[model samples]
Target: MKKAEVVLIPIPAMGHIVALVEVAKLLVERDDRLSTTIFIMHPVLDPSTTKYTESLAASTLPDRMRVVNLPNLESNTEDTKDRNWLNSMIESQKPRVEEYVSKMRTQSQLSPDSPQLAGFIFDTFATGMKDVANGFGVPWYVFSASGAAFICSMFYLQALHDGEGVNLTEFKNSDALLEVPGLANPLPAKLLPSMVFREDLLAIFLEHARTLKETRSILVNTFLEFESYAVHSLSNGKNPPVYPVGPMVKHVADGRDLRSDESNKYRDIMEWLDDQPPSSVMFLCFGSWGSFCGKQVKEIACALEHCGHRFLWSLRKPSSQKGKIESPSDYLNFQEILPEGFLDRTLEIGKVIGWAPQVDILAHPAVGGFASHCGWNSILESVRFGVPVATWPLYAEQQFNAFQMVIDLGLAVEIKMDYWRDFLGDNEIIVSSDDIVKAIKHVMEEDSEVRKKVKEMSRISEKSLKDGGSSFSSLGRLIEDMIDNIS
Candidate 1:
């Protein structure tokens, strides 16, 4: 019997790429009949990123794994520039997919039969890869870098099939409750990701959702027990088979030791965290794509001051504006996006940096709560760290994720805004700043029952990732299913 040759394609970003590396390692250690190869795509690979990838590859079973680096097609250009993120993503992927297909074909020429490319594992944003896989007549599996709840939401295809279209504008006046077939709770239109409201992007997402049904399977980077509602919902119904194999960081659980001695950049953040009191610091971050206008930044700063908490805030310059270093007072140019005097007032208890070691910071004892944009990756990390969440959901599936945290799971408290109508582009709906203050206080303050509940939920989250746990069993089952299907 010939061993299978699996080609894994991972999107850029530390979190996105690591899961695939872990899965490849798992496949090699579990079976002698399987061999794996990794193909990485990104703008630039730094030494830190390279070391992390190499460590995973090297630590895995020898001789069964291979790592390949492909030229990044979009390296010369700015990712956050005016390029339509959706269209740019589709166009950029075409060349890379073509390149991979070309390489596979070339490999087949060297050996008459090169084990017939068993499968292609892709990141969530790599929708075009499915077409390439289909072209090559191989199985394609979407590897979600987030939680099961996030992917389950994508599988609800009734709205797409009903010809309702993917625009939120269409559902603006719709008060009708939507029954997501496999979810534990009814999904309100307000809870959907902001992108779902945009007809063009929504169409693209729905198309991907449709493709999910046609693909080999959907693999989520999560454990079964952590999101049982979502996992079960996606599994039992008309939805495609869902595989939960996660907390992928288990392979890199050794902490700061994973950071190579060559660059001490990560050392500064880790050292600062060591001095803070246990569960006293608030960890604030928006993922790589998350940015705020200067006005919103000021308001957040004001809120942080009012909360009186020691916090580490990750502040990236606003991507909407380029080559400008405007202060919080530059409200006129930034369109009231941030609150005034936010920085001057909060300097005492807050340390703001461009980026921070999020996972390491969260796992630190001093970190008590997270104020986040509610990205699924951030949410999962928060849960793993046993930190409570103060939800400030932004675009994409963040709104849905925030809603699920606050309303469905009761694991987080939602920050309110008085200008909800202004922010939402809906004049009728009103939200207030008082809501924000209250929610933040509830999550950060020790007296609040909600804070206690989050701590308990955190423990449950930790248990799911342990050996022989729900997540562990699910991963084993997923590997078995893949092997069985191939054989």
Candidate 2:
């Protein structure tokens, strides 16, 4: 039997790269005839992302898998707020990718032992590679790091603007609900992604949605049981085939953890959790980019003290640089931002730290609930561990994910559905301590319906990965389709 290789192109961010690589690993494990090569496009500002790629390249991969780092391109990320920065950065890499893949094709043609190119699998933002796949005459797929509902919402947004001539910017302040396919409830206009407020961002976003129609398939990092309505809606043959082959979270049981290193502080966190009682602690972590102004930090401090729950908070200092994707860093002194006497008063009941072993902590018995930014990966991780989330979305498509959890799925309690971070200043409304306290209490309630729902879904999420389950079957179909397209 002839062997084949699939090329993977993921955005340089940690979250995107990790998810797509899991898909590659699964593909190779499931079929002996398949192999994968992940092309890493380095991010401009974050050294952490580049470092992660280095570690992955150094690690022992499966028999037929490899990670290739493309040559670094010097680029400016100073105007990151302009919305054109990401699109421009991704577009600029086209020549490098084309040249590399063109060379791979030539090498395969010369050697009979080399694996033939099977297909191109790209992260949704990297869809600019469509033309290269076209030139090479191979099928290309778009892998959504988000859920199926997000993809459906993207399609709906594009249709509303181009087909119906609806002005999307109006949704920023309008008290209207958006009725779209795939969601069980009518989506509040305010919960739409922040990109809708700006024409420049919206144009780039809609272009990606439009490009999905031209792909061979869309592979979402969600399971069928998780997003049945959205998956079924997209599979109606009007769009390309949609495959839900995930809930692709790290298996803590497999000894893989997301902690940065084996430092004493990281070790102390897990040890502290071990001392606490089961389902007693509220774990608060925003994603890598999540941070807040001093005033907001104080409000969260007030709530944590008032609620008096056993808490583990991963608090990061906001980056001082303006208009850049530089990730927030750890504060040297917690006293500078936190309220006076707050730390002393709650010292025994709470533990505040920078960065977290999120997968490890969630898997621990002591974690009762998660106060989260509702990043799709975080949502999946929380669900996998049966940890109910108190949604406090910061930006991007997180507000939509929060809404889906609270309104459509009834799987989480709401903190605030539409919280957009203002990197310029604190223009957004402040979420009061009272609201935070309320959400924490609701999520931690032992008999709460949301908690029950999450526990049940956790079982389903696990089952979906077993031999004959939903995600397992979807993955099988995706592999079969890719093999069938081999020329």
Candidate 3:
């Protein structure tokens, strides 16, 4: 039998890349006749994203699977705040990506040992490739690096806007509750998604939503039992199938670790955790799309200091770090950028570093709480490790994830629960030191309600991955279905 060579086009960001890479690994692990070629698009500003991709390329992956970085020719004309740039930049890569895939297909077909092009699998942001996949007469699948609720929300938003001619932005500022079928709690219109904030992004985001119907299936990075309502809402006989094969972070038990490449940077972090008592440290991290500003970082420093909680913060610089270099304040160390005497005063109690071993830290016994941006991947990781959260969302359905995690799952405490934080714009959030202090205490204090719930949820998360379990069965079916699609 001929093997299926699936070309994966990920959304060129760290979070999206990590999720789809795990899917590729899962696909290869379960099938002898399958292989993947992940075509990574070049990301903006952050050199770490590029380096991370390159590291994956250089790593020892399975022979049937490999990584290829697309050319860094994408234009950087658009400002980071104008997120339409991402949609546009991804759109601009279509002709080049299609051309590259066509060439790859030609070369591989000339060799008998090389696999036939089974299809293309793209991250939700790379949905423009749907046309390319159709042009080549092959299957295309969309991988949503979020939960089932998010998938339903996006598609439902498109249907609502296009079908009814309603203004989603208008609803965003209104007091109405969003009624997505699968979620038990009503999603506030204000917390819908960052794309709703800008009128220009509507076309592209809807492009992502509408194209899902054209694909063979929708693959989400979530488990079945966890998001049953949202997953169920996505299912109908006529619509594309939805599959859940996730909580797919890498770990030693899987004989693989995603952050192995960053082992050197994280070794120190692990050693620091070793010295702390069990369940004593609060681990703080925001997703790539949302990092604290210097002013906000200082506030966090002050909060950590005042609250007297032992903590480990995985800090990220703003994306436009190069632009900030003109100022003497933008230094190499976070300590350099922090408030006067902040580091010295809290040196023993809280350690703030520029990067961290996130999964490793969550798995560490000393980490009791996660003050997170509530990205779906982070939520899953925290749950898997029995770490409760202080929901502090930044952007892009993160508020949706945060609200759901707190209201729907009862696994987290709230930091700034009701509001939406745009991309450091007019309506951007400024979380005060006092609020942070309260939130951290709610998460880290022993025998808190959130902690007890998270511990229970963690057991459920683990059990779902076991054989004959809901997630396990779902994954088995997903693999079987993909194999059937190959024929």
Q: Which candidate is the best by TM-score?
A: 2
Ranking by lDDT: 2, 3, 1
Q: Quote the RMSD, in angstroms, for model 1.
A: 5.6
* Candidate 3 TM-score over all chains jointly: 0.90
Using all chains and alpha carbons, the TM-scores for the candidates as numbered come to: 0.78, 0.96, 0.90
lDDT of every predicted structure (CA atoms): 0.65, 0.88, 0.79
Q: Give the worst 10-residue stretch by lDDT in candidate 1.
A: 417-426
Query: What is the overall TM-score of model 1 with all chains considered together?
Result: 0.78
Q: For model 1, how does the per-residue alpha-carbon lDDT over 385-481 read when each residue is reduced to its tens digit?
A: 7788988775566777777788777888877411221221223432344565676677778757767776776777667656777766766766665
**Candidate topping lDDT:** 2
Separate clash counts for every candidate = 13, 0, 1
What C-alpha lDDT, on a 0 to 100 scale, does residue 217 get in candidate 2? Answer: 92
The alpha-carbon lDDT assigned to residue 279 of candidate 2 equals: 99
Clashes of 1: 13
- For lDDT, candidate 2 versus 3, the one ahead is 2
